[model samples]
Target: MEAAIAVLVAQFKAFAGADGSTDTLSKGEFQNLVTSQLPNLVKNSADPAVIEQLMSSLDQNDDGELTFLEFWQLVGRLANQHGGFSR
Candidate 1:
């Protein structure tokens, strides 16, 4: 769980910038960031079906990008679902 969170944080940092800040990512930037970073988890997802569903469900803002809160929420949700973490 920690590892997963760490990986996500690192990816967010990379997308946001060398300063490792989430505040720097714009809406579009966040979308691109997720598109590039979440390949492994999202690759086998459904068509316009799963991707669209996830984008709408997870993106939160509908800005076509994910904020830090959204990112963390998704991670926490997955962790819970997979028994990767408790509380």
Candidate 2:
């Protein structure tokens, strides 16, 4: 579980920027990150053209980058869909 969390965090950081802090991302930056890193999930996203289209729906802030809560919500949803961690 810890390892999975770390991998998720690292992936988020990669998208979020070298600063790797959620606070550092602009809406555009966050969208780019999702497009590149979350291709599997976001490729089929309802609005595939702009990353912000999907992110804005999920983010709810219209501010762009996801807050930690938003990020965790995404991960949790995905994990539930995918059956979460395995032994």
Candidate 3:
């Protein structure tokens, strides 16, 4: 569990730091992260508009960027879906 959490944080930091901001993920960075790291888990990995829509949904503050907390919402949802915990 600890390692999984650590990996999540590390992945978030790795992607978030692409634009020199480890605190938030820009649209481009988020797209890259999803298409590259989560291609199998995230649907429409090849569609730019889908990515944009996803980013919009995750951008809680409407700042065009996703904070770690916002990113975690995605991770949690994915985990739930992958684990068959979502109804």
Top-TM-score structure, candidate number: 3
Worst-scoring 10-residue span by lDDT in model 2: 42-51
Q: Estimate each model's TM-score.
A: 0.53, 0.61, 0.94
| Per-residue lDDT of model 3, residues 1-87, tens digit only | 999999889999999999898999999899999999999999997799998888888888899999999998898889999999998
For all the candidates, what are their Cα RMSDs to the real structure? 4.9, 4.6, 0.9
What are the lDDT scores of the predictions, listed in order? 0.63, 0.63, 0.91
Worst 10 residues of 3 by lDDT: 51-60
Order of candidate numbers by lDDT, starting with the best: 3, 2, 1
Error of 2 at 69 (Å): 1.9
lDDT per residue for candidate 1 within 1-87, as digits (tens), equals 799778877777778763355554554455566566665555544345555566567776677656678767766666575675654
- Model 1 has an lDDT value of 0.63
| TM-score, cand. 3 | 0.94
